[model samples]
Target chain A: MSTTTLSKATLSHLDWLEAEAIHIMREVAGQCANPVLLFSGGKDSICMLRVAEKAFRPGRFPFPLMHIDTGHNYKEVTDFRDKRAAELGERLIVRSVEESMARGTVVLKSADESRNKHQSVTLLEAIEEFGFDACIGGARRDEEKARAKERICSFRDEFGQWDPKNQRPELWSLYNARAFKGENIRVFPISNWTEIDVWQYIEREKLELPSIYFAHTRPVVRKAGGMLPVTEITPAKPGDVVEDVLVRFRTVGDITCTAPVESAADTVAKIIEETATTTITERGATRLDDQTSEASMEQRKKEGYF
Target chain B: MSAIENIPAQGNAVDNGLLRFLTCGSVDDGKSTLIGRLLFDTKTILADTLHAIERTSQKRGMEAVDLSLLTDGLQAEREQGITIDVAYRYFTTGTRKYIIADAPGHEQYTRNMVTAASTANLAIILIDARKGVLTQTRRHSYLAHLVNIPHVVVAVNKMDLVDYSQERFEQIKADYLAFAAKLGIDDVRFIPMSALNGDMVVERGERLAWYDGPTLLDILETAPPAHTERAEKFRFPVQYVCRPQDSANPELHDYRGFMGRVESGELAAGDAVTVLPSGLETRVKAIELYGEKLPRATSEQSVTILLEDEIDISRGDMIVKTSELPNVAKQIDAMLCWLSETPLDPRRKYVVRHTTRESKAMLAGIEYRMDINTMERQPAEKLAMNDIARVSLKLAQPLFTDPYVDSRGTGAFIVIDESSNNTVGAGMIL
Candidate 1:
């Protein structure tokens, strides 16, 4: 083939996905005045950071990095988050669920209750404190059923509640990131990507991820039809079955709700290979929070959960 | 089929391009079944997801897997069991990756179809083989043509209901082509299939032997990607200016780069360019992608460009080759689609956001409003929900744009309601 034909055919799926993501990031920067990117030290957010770097480099990012800590997350991921922010020399803001609890905002029914849902409260409080008009997240539409219907630039009320039925009409590449005084827009740059696509981009970009994503022989308790990662906050009960099985985390979230799956994939290549043949979805195989009900994510999202 | 089922660990869909298309039809037309068949045949649905849907189906005492359960449950209320929003689904075949924008077709939901049609390269207008071409068919075809989708495939669904007759399929094809030609749609393909029985979707089942053409998946794999089908007129809109004056780093001083996407065409070093609205001309200094100097910048690549001459340019400015200049006008005539519940108040001023430029525009005049069902252009004073009208707009600032047909990136815009801060309308330059 001629060089022109080769160039035309060279724009692979990953290239198209990366360009679309960068375009979305730049749109948020151009439209919103004060925005912050919600970064968790997971594989998805790691890929998102690389996209942000590609979007605005040689200069600093247009927005700061913020994390709504559940206060029950793995220490390794949080440590990586801090280190990555320090290396980039960008501002990092962390507001915890503990802070919200002390402020009488987040209330738990039991002492051992999961703090994952309360992250929304801390996130909204942080948004109010920082006066941010847009909050860029690494939420993908393919992750769960509820996110599939969300727009690229999602609108939130003053209470941070999302009205799924009444979303703005996003047309062509022209995004509507405008919001009123107390309202905000949740901008998702990677909404079009899937699990394997994220893995492909990470492998192609050679991005670094948290170590917990790789397989390791870790002790875990089996519950919620998933292997719950044994942690200080949520330890195994007397009658609970515990095993030191080799596993890897598909999604790295709050330790109280995030679980690991039985896997031997220690590298990105192996993980991609495992993902292609696996019958379970990323969330279905791991996420302990989603086992409650089908409408739970939608209900929580309506109440300002990310 | 076995080869597709066993997806390879390496080199998965890297050699092929991506196809983004939308499926348009009502629930009665078996639209959901067709989408489900595509995902199922390609093995995109995992075991856990299929199991969940199977349980839901069994609970309702229905036989077999309820394929509609794959969609229609997210964000949309189940009062009518109809999906209202445009839910996007992704699946990959060995040859190409697909992004299916599942949109509903009711007169009140015209905005959803327009939103999906805007980004789609092709549209699958599903027609029930028994009912032939209905008003909904015409609406979808018209909107697809209006959005300038390059290829449209009219899938005559429910062939099993019509006993897989070639005469019925040909009759429906004839009806659709007659309607398509009226709307100036030149590139349309027809397929006969039964999504429930799995005929002609992925595999040519035993029934459709009389027809000899590419399957739906076959046609989508060869469809051109977005920018290749359009005219190559280089139009770059300057989004933001990057000036990193880090005194700590000596090499970063006095560095100013124009940050934006290459909306169309391509650019190389030493190409003479002009900054619009200022009319200042300069040469391309360098194109930087993550601090790496690139030899050329093509369409849709978001990069920073440094000009040889230090001209005063900021956001809302257009960068184009002096050879090919777009029309710089303060007054634009467009076909605008009303997307909001609030009617258009002609006396009020709205914000016209086109490319990177934002201008205050007024509803100067409404030439005619399109009745979506009847396909008639009627005189109207105001536009309500799902209304398309040819209107005259006077802008507070000049926007350099081309017709939407010729250049999608530089020609489309959105109107914002100032009081509510809502995107109320979508406009395409005429």
Candidate 2:
């Protein structure tokens, strides 16, 4: 109930990052007519939710919260997504890949194939169905090479395609979020944030996240030199040895492709320490699918994968 | 693993602050190589990434590792062996963090360079020592000044090819200084180094004993923070209006707060402010930052402001101190950089988005297009892509704005083609 005067003011990198993110969020809210925050219950999206709160706190968000469920995700993440949205009393719209498969829009090569890339079809369908003009995502520029080439407010064509070579020139903080009727813009507020920054922010803000991020004993199978989580959608293959190891997921994607690393860091502070010392990038060490092709991420992005 | 121990902790280094810089020069001036070396020397490049780059280098028929491959991440860039867009790379030394915007040096990609320079605190202009100063170097320098980058470091790269001659370095430096002086650039520094050899980039090499200057990393670590020269003036552009009517929290029933990030200066409780375009005056009751009330808020802090009296205010409204008001007008003259491939048509109506306001604007007249290479002005009827020209525009509504030379946050805007919805140009108010 008491106010304290801030003296000797010097803004830290985190403060600058937070302000920049909030500003971008506000720009999206002001420009886009039908906008939605893509919530996946990940650390980046959690930080985004916090920024949204700061940007528009005493009032409801201008748009709803939506999720494109891959149906192969961990229960912990989806549960956290629902609970967080409920607590905030915001509208959460969920569209699943299963629906796309049922509608014959997504055809997989095999039953065991990962549904990660096919989520783009479901996401596009959802965009068309709801007429979302803009989708605010938690993608970071440092996450991948293609993402680094993207503008903060990336524009998509009528078919929801990304053209890296031909992008709008984003100067200063003045982002051009204008789009045609069918065209939508994918806004990345935290594009400048590095992985270390995210963890540092998590530690500073004390944000709640899914428990799978911390080190825990979980059943897993060693495949392609990465530990693939043993979920119902991703069961162990023949002659695959399952083991219970102390591990944690640096990034959470579909269970079929997401991998975990061996670590004993169970808390946010410890995770920060681990992240600082680790030599491998989060995707390089944990993603079973990204290592297969060098241009896969870019190709998927062009097809409208967030 | 000892090398890993040598790396500084992220907590201490990042806390010192972050520096955003851009590297630009003519094509093949080793801009990517310089950035790659910085990352490599800082140990910020992961081992997996290094191995991948090495494999890629071998496949490209190179005997040694091609460090430039570390950047040039896109498939087209790998195949064409040229950087076509701006790529951002991050690294950290034990004392400071850096965000390097590696911009393409080709003349066609000048828009990309402008984009990078917009947010850069400093610029490292790389020049091949063999070719002292080319037109592209001058063009980049002009662009850097156009965006008001605080510091400019002229790095004469490929020093090994020129035998690391201090005479050549001094000659290049003198020529650059003369050119920069003409552009009114005061804070300019020069360094000679070989990005390919990792000399004078991160560590001071014995080969450069003749040249006594701080290494590139040292200079970056010691340079003063940016935007400290301008006099402080509060300019808060209302980005959104917050009014929470949730019954669960009774305290927020009648709350109406104007949300925005302070673009410059500071705002405190009880400070009298004026809303622009509307010309309504009020006093600041309190500043709220995410559920907590603060006595004051400084520049770059996103907070909600509660007014002592409720008034009709919405997005695109500027709130500033009553004594300090920006220029409010519908007709203005400015310099614009055309970004789209389509030429600028004087008869076309475009949308100009400035701060939080959007208005239909039409080009009134084309004064002249400046030749980036020679700094000569030539009368032009139409502006092609990547052309920098001085022009006059008439807006449908008055915009509260300032000259870019005074306040960058309040003076810049973008031109959008309404039909295609593509951002076609960037304009700086004169």
Candidate 3:
């Protein structure tokens, strides 16, 4: 028999990824005391929601749905977020950074600064408020450098920080979710998923998502070679020329920081096709806050940002 | 170039989706480096990660950032420029996403590879272009076949070291093809590429003009997902028991539910299922998840089921569809890959964890030790670390299982050393 013909018995790559993800999701629900699905209204989180539906559907979810609102989120996304959560009949809990700031727990460098890094403090507070032992996140390993180094059931300190150097050894499918009081585990269900996998699963599930994912004509100003969305919170500079461009957000985040990529691919199929050929990384194209090394994802995750 | 998708889109349907893959090869064959290249060239490696790799390489007095250093995390592995443990890396393309278990190639690390590829849908066995096929290659290929990874990609790496010769590539490909045929590996793809210099990896190479096929990532993105919907039986191993704590909620307080995810196949609410090891039979009354009831529970879903009759069931008990009961046996023969530094003791008893069932297993006998390089099985009295041999185990109790070749989730098990609690070896049922 031909060499090519002999390999047909092997399981395809995606089947393995799906099975593992499903297994991890079930493990979290089985082991943890109070687990909550952390939704960001992004494609990855949307994929997590679908996986959860497959994992624990036909019945109410074992845990509630939650989001750590930055108070700088896109209006379109947060609006859709409320609607989607209501439609699913699942509890949607929002712990706002604005409330944390008011309560003197979150201090900013400036009044108009991006609240991306400060999200950690608010998240830790929310975890404490709900006494959630496991916070199920949509963080994928393929997303960033720090995330790549994390365990699927990443253990967090009582302070809600991640120490990459002191992680537990995760071998085979045996994950250690053991922790003491005041400590919690940050469980990433789609840690194995890629950007393309998220989009494909999104298309497959016909999951209702925020409109920012698809390409649409919007008013924007070019800054640092990225199309910065024209928002009142993040106004354009004097020299920056505002223009109309058909663009889509590769990743959705706090509106003050998330940028858009130039594209006319208005549908999921188009997005999938466009994603295949794009050379720039997902965070590189859209997340303006991640451009610097000082405020990196690792630092944010270390400070308790999911 | 963007319109070159050739694989069927499986994840486009609600019922069909993602595939998981693993990679195995010899230590110096660039398995870790190849995975790093795939992640980097695919743009899955973030800029910050590249910067970190660059810094670490500089500290190690290397002019070029060694891609293998990204996976060789242990201090010992870094000093040796080899993989000592199974390092997992994740990435995605438009067509499919991948999670790779880059298992070490050393003889002692064979058990690590088994653990890595146990759940893998596909396996990529890297063969060095200059070295052609080595014993480690055969051993890894055999293990991949044993674990039943449905797809195998024979990536002929370091073609640059071989002058990009088509004859050399074809020769190696033919050798692999011949051996793979004997092992029942039907879906194998041979690709020629240089992992270090980026030849036919993410982009098509200018060198090797004779080759006409998709890049490694391209092939990966378009490869078909393994279809296992036709599994003969359904199994659900209970993980927990749920009963609401609130006294006010009377409807939930008395609702005793057996919680677990279906390991394989599908089961309807009224379908009859047999409890294995105990041999008791019952019918499903309702499939519940949280507070809602479902008509059915498919494989991989975490749903709690209420049986029509309250037959005794708990964790470690197998709930299999009555129509498809597996072979229940007290003793099993299997191919074992030893992992521990301490050699196997014939008199010792260890805990054998198969699926959810944990039973005491004693070493009955070692049949033979495999010479991976020569594809020879030598009769052995004892097995040492990294030795692959067929062994017989006398179990304290019967286990419900299929052959490892038939089903991975239920057919294989791990031997945990009782004293140290270390996973010493993995076995595939024969």
Quantify all predictions' global Cα lDDT against the true fold: 0.87, 0.87, 0.75
Better of 1 and 2 by TM-score: 1
> What's the TM for model 3?
0.72
Write model 3 residue lDDT over A12-74, tens digit each, in one string: 344444546666876777667798998878778877877676565444578999999998898
What would the per-residue lDDT of candidate 3 be over residues B1-430, giving only the tens digit for each residue? 2332422255332222445678887657877778778777766655556776798889879999888766655444455666655656765553454667766778766667776787677788899999998877888888887767777888999999999999999999999889888777788898999988888888776897899977887777665555353454687877655554547656655566776766666788899989866888989999865455677766555567888886777766788899888889789999887877788888889888777667899988888887766778799988887788999999998888888766666777888776655567778899
Model 1: per-residue Cα lDDT over B218-288, one tens digit each: 88778886645545888889888888898998888989988888888888889999899999999999988
lDDT of 2: 0.87
Q: TM for chain B in all models?
A: 0.96, 0.96, 0.89
In candidate 2, position B33 carries an lDDT of: 83
**After best superposition, candidate 2 residue A80: deviation in angstroms?**
1.5
| Interface RMSD measured for model 1 | 2.2
Model 1 alpha-carbon drift over 4 Å, by segment: A1-9, B1-14, B227-230
- For residues A112-172, could you state the per-residue lDDT of candidate 2 as single tens digits? 8999999889999999999999999999988889888998999998878999889888988
Clashing pairs in 2: A58-B244
On DockQ, the candidate that comes out on top is 1
DockQ of 2: 0.60
Q: Which candidate, 2 or 3, would have the higher DockQ against the true structure? A: 2
